[model samples]
Target: MLIPTRVRPSELDRLIAAVDPDLRAPLRGRVDLGGTPLSRATLAAARNSIITPRPLPAPPIAARRIAGVPGAPPVSLYVINQGEPGTRRPAILHIHGGGYVLMRADDTFPQLQTIARAHDCVIVTVDYRLAPETRFPGARDDNEAALRWLHREADSLGVDRSRIAVMGESAGGGHAAMLALAARDRGEVSLVAQILVYPMLDDRTGSRRMPRTGIGEIGWTSAQNRFGWGALLGVAAGSSVVPSGAVPARVPDLAGLPPTFIAVGSIDLFVDEDIDYAHRLIDAGVSTDLMVLDGAYHGFDGAVPDAPVTRRFVASRDAALRRAFTPGGWRRG
Candidate 1:
């Protein structure tokens, strides 16, 4: 298949054209001979580049202590409540994408605000522990604890515990999926749905050792995937084994899980695994919705928000989430 050379979104074309040719080269996927694997500092810088702060802000609805977590520090919950104080709305526990290494509550401000406003739901975006220092289960534990807290205080928060959903992007998406699995096994903290956007599901990097297909169109290369996974798992990039919770795909028995919305760009490295996981969800009797956007790459929605295709992709995701929040039988797409 021939990959079309990506052009800047029409709105940004002039701005992109005005940029120095050298800078534009990198944006166009041209690698710099001098550029090496980002140093810790450089990696941090690269991460920041992708997470542009939302200039406009919305105030959080309100916050209160739900359930006190044992041993760990108190989780400060940020909530955006919709409707009256007594009436309930669907709730979402959002986890931000950052390869499980970097990101903050503020980073997801725009998305949370939009969801809260559009869906009339309470959106809780957590500030979870990062990896390297804090590995697998650390973030998961924090997420679970937060979920438990939310369940306990659902009444006070005007949320229906049964209507709760878990949503996340990238590594956060992986965590959300794992949390759904963990909740199912526990048999108490039932989740209504899971929204996983371009999630990194499998830690078994070698599952497909064949040469990576569609390199340029995919955006994120094999080297970067290994680096992020290695950092999160606290092992060498190509290590022979990875621990459980390190990767969502590592968990077996995806049966009896809630419905799921799994999406990925056709060219994303995670495309194969996401597709496989979606099949597993369906095989296990879980309702699954999958979208494969053409001529797009990993993180395209955020990376190129101005592009028409990117907007269409984002709209599909938002619509999926909205349908999930609907009561009774979910509206099939």
Candidate 2:
């Protein structure tokens, strides 16, 4: 597939320059995953190379372990509180995106701290179990466990139970979407909103024969997507039998879900699925806000933080979050 000639020249330049040379070479045309497969070791090495010691927040965020449901493993939750000690603040349950296979809870602390300070809310980043070793529902269970723990200990943690929201990027976003559905079905918890940042929502997305989006050319390729989903599902990607909870796009209904905020680049691999999900949410009578960045690709905001497109993306996301956290701002569906 040829690179979309429709991409703005300036954005295309940034995309090419930001991607690694090796990746840039393959991105000019269709990528061959079979020739260069993504392995667990390779992914781990890449993650380690980028991992750095993040400085503590000014007031310091508390890090602690909380027990998951009776038999589940204990999960790590990073609590960022910028409000007064006793004041109940709106909370955001943040899930980090590593295709559901890589990255730790602390990898998201920098952004969590920023959001916590910006919104003056309690931010909790959950270190959910990763895949291959732990399959479907294992990671989801850990996230749900953290949510239950937060609500149960709300008073003590100074979190406003009524205003809690779930937010995440990529696989994390997928998890947030599933978590919202599960929470609704179980009738155990209520959410003010769900912020899905270019969520990886569909398994079939990996098999779709689509033109190369410059963004997917380098980072997060279809082959990688296949590996990630396969590891998480314990089955091949695009398998005939897969659980709706594991793949949000498969869910038959989008009703009863909280107001949703979805942002994706026009050229992202998940673009179609994200847009379709947004339309479905609106059709289901859910208040949905969708932002499609022109001439952008997957993880564009993080990949080029200072780019004009990225700045706009960050601003839009922060605005959506602020509105959701505001008292009585979210209209229950």
Best by lDDT: 2
Model 1 earns a TM-score of: 0.81
Q: Ten-residue segment with the worst summed lDDT in candidate 1? A: 1-10
Q: Can you give the TM-score per candidate against the true fold?
A: 0.81, 0.87
Query: Against the true structure, whose TM-score is highest?
Result: 2
lDDT of each: 0.68, 0.78
Cα deviation in Å at residue 114, candidate 1? 1.2
Clashing pairs in 1: none
lDDT at 63, model 1: 55
Off by over 4 Å in 2: 1-36, 82-85, 208-215
